[model samples]
Target: MAKNTGASKFRKVNVDEYDEENFQDNEDADVGVVGPNENEVSNFLNQSKNVEALKAVLQNPPQGCKDKRLKDKVVQVVVRVLSAFKTSDIEKGVNALDSQSLDTLMKYIYRGFEFPSEGSSATLLSWHEKVYAKGGSGCIIRVLTDRKTL
Candidate 1:
């Protein structure tokens, strides 16, 4: 046997030291489900401010929204607003949005694709093309990486 020199200190730990009570359960944590303001959205729609409403919806979606029906309602509103835009105005309206708004729009566009309605595919495709041109692939990447869903 070779001569032993203790230059470091270490000890084997007992697995029994870890018990169920040692871990704290976090299942009851408080959750915030912030949805869009209905009155505000209705007001925008009633005023025919589709562009503004679109920007508002994209900028501030219902974070942590759990209700599928609620999300569908919001998506319907967005799709309706998108459909309302005249073909001639699509480019102009899209160009007016800031980068953040553009990315959010891209996110909604993909979400919209999940629930396709009659004639919505073409409109969403138009929007996707325009947003991709302005935001490039980075916008898609951001949308994919983002944890928040609209």
Candidate 2:
């Protein structure tokens, strides 16, 4: 007698059981639409070259005391953009930043240090260290200062 194998217990599935018509194609499916104006910061960051644009936006922020949310968004965008700066760009970027922009960056860093769990404090510190190493005098001085105003 032939020895029975586990393969003998398996049954072949019907090829016709799968309905191709019922299957949806994800290639053209609309996952979701991302509007340009919806998340300006994310849209700006997604661009190929946005340093100039970011600087312009930072220099001329939205006018109005009620635009606190917009100001926060700008801060978030600045932090993200600054964090993305390469070592070679750090010095130039740091130099180009106005005092207000610097203060904004410092505020974000200070918030991170104040609330370790809420933000990327360590990442910010590392970026500052990188900037310092790359001869970013302004960034180094700003980071070293103990001013609570920022």
Q: Which candidate comes out best when scored by TM-score? A: 1
Model 2, span 45-115: residue lDDT tens: 66734565446445543323234565455545555655565656656665666666664455455544543
Q: Cα RMSD for candidate 1?
A: 5.6
| TM-score for each candidate, following the candidate numbering | 0.71, 0.41
RMSD of each: 5.6, 18.0
> What Cα-based lDDT does every candidate model obtain?
0.76, 0.51
Candidate 2 clashes between residue pairs 3 or more apart in a chain or in different chains: none
Clashes of each: 0, 0
Error of 2 at 6 (Å): 99
Q: Over the stretch 70-149, how does candidate 1's per-residue lDDT look in tens digits?
A: 87787777787788777776787788799988877887788899888899999999988888888889999998998777
Q: Which stretches of candidate 1 lie over 4 Å from their true place?
A: 1-33
lDDT of 2 at 118: 36
lDDT of 2 at 62: 33
